[model samples]
Target: MIRHQRQNYDWGINAEGSSLEGGAAQVAMNGDTVFIHYICRDEDGNMVDDSAESEDHPVSFEVGAGEITGNPLFQAFDEAIRGLPLGSTTVLEARGGDWNRELFFEVPRDHAEIQRLEGRYKNQGGLQDGLIVELSNGGSAMVVAVTDDVVKIDANNMLAGKRRIFEVTLLNIEPAQR
Candidate 1:
């Protein structure tokens, strides 16, 4: 594997730039749900995710509510799409690291959060291991460690501490209703 050079950027919402592709009068707006194809790679140029490879490609989400992605980096990415016409694309080079070091939390095995998580994930696979949970703060975290008395959850991105390269193309936009 070839290691790529790392680039410096602000912690959250560090937008490198964006380029509009074809000529389209329609521009992504605040309430519109935008569809986009994206590829994520690490500084080493390793592919983290590609929307095209999965059935979830051309991901769709409302521009305003995109903050559901739950990170300053992603929030900025969603914000960048607003006003971009169809066929436009954007680039974000985010530095990988625990945006919040406090992401590690240990909760009692019988805590409400733990119970709720167990109930929510029971059908999927239960909270045994490697389960992703939605945080009250809106960020998502992976179950890193589990024990009889306590469960340790880490909200850090899997690629934390590594520079990430995101190339996103705006495929389509659904206008707001009402």
Candidate 2:
């Protein structure tokens, strides 16, 4: 693969200079704050996540750190984002990684609720269509499947099996203090 070159760097969200792009990327630096709007999608072109959810949802991050991009689509993003101007828009195709597939439990569950909900859902349809199960305690689980009398619900950070596409624009960047 061809090695891409470093481009421009900017200081803060309030740049007085005109927009920056490809060849003009020398203005961008690792420590410079970057303001961007972006959308992330799966290889099949389905929307995964996007900054467009709200006016304040655009992404902001230091140029080189790995915080905002722990997903498998990092390389494609790094390449596609190269030399993008402040207001420019870009789309990145990302495949889900293990980190995106692992389920996380926010609240502990006793075996009783698990058994009850599973048994109630057994041989039931509409599980995969999506069902929200309200726990006796606060919070809910999105039911994904029911089989062998087992209700297979996964609460993971990553949306499973779906391709995600993202539309992004640079919003703001603040380099962290050393």
Candidate 3:
């Protein structure tokens, strides 16, 4: 079962760019697919990610599917969206742990992805310390240090160990197909 808290949205006000607001609609339930756009920030109010700027906008996920087990963000989102009205903009909160084996890990400097980043910025004085490089896998990592033989990279989710605030707009919801 999913556990969560709730602070429902105000009535009659539309979520940004949402055309479904104020219309009769069913609430999202488990086994339903939800379309959403969200902006997440940490305790310090630093923007973590804005789905609007992502290549894949209006992302969809199934509530309670837990396809990626042990992901707290996913769990929190499942908690937030379940039973939420369509076309509502809700604030979802979660406290992240400092460590997650799947998210926090290091890779060799010579790793293909790192090398690719190095190649991209080669003419620009090469890779530098503290440069956050975008990975081909759609993830990002910070360059801890670059040494003669090895580079240190920290690919931890930025939300780890911090209070998270997700302003999630529920654009639409539909029954999960299959």
Candidate 4:
């Protein structure tokens, strides 16, 4: 069964530490696919990138499976949503060196899809045409060539060297099986 909540609250802790919010615990475990919606802004409060503006707004990926690696933005997100509660919205303040920003995320308790990537396959002789392959670790690569002994693959994620802020909302959580 799936559940959802549409509420917004102040997740910040003031200097005096007066208000303390409490709710159910929702931790994202390994192998679980999480769906989220997000927006990003720079230190100067300028809108940098927003997932809500994309055609497939709210992207989904498996957690702790290295599905969305090579990107600093997603790397920060993986760290932020580790133990986030479902059906709640919170702001995350990330600071490193002179870079500081806030990420807002809303995680819904429902909505998820489990996808499994197949293992490597060896051709009898060799592959002549190029083929895109999805790795078992949830990563992807393009097969440039295949020979009797070796297979050449290009595993590069274009967002590897980019820097950007992100506002993410968790829309669903599929817990890993025991």
- Measured with C-alpha atoms, the lDDT of residue 175 in candidate 4 is 86
Q: Best TM-score goes to which candidate?
A: 1
- Give the alpha-carbon lDDT of every model: 0.76, 0.49, 0.70, 0.49
List the candidate 2 regions with Cα displacement exceeding 4 Å: 1-27, 40-50, 67-83, 97-142, 146-149, 154-160, 171-178
* Clash-forming residue pairs, model 3: 97-161
The per-residue C-alpha lDDT of model 4 at residue 163 equals: 33
Cα shift from native, residue 120, model 3 (Å): 14
Q: What is candidate 4's lDDT per residue for 149-174, written digit by digit as tens?
A: 44555555422233334556677898
Q: Quote each prediction's TM-score.
A: 0.58, 0.46, 0.57, 0.44
Off by over 4 Å in 4: 1-23, 89-164
Model 4 scores worst on lDDT over the 10 consecutive residues at 11-20
TM-score of 1: 0.58
**Candidates in descending TM-score order:** 1, 3, 2, 4
Error of 4 at 17 (Å): 15
- Winner by lDDT: 1
lDDT of 3 by residue, 103-122 (tens): 54456777887688889878
How high a TM-score does candidate 3 get?
0.57
Candidate 4: residue pairs that collide: 39-167, 105-168, 106-169, 106-170, 107-170
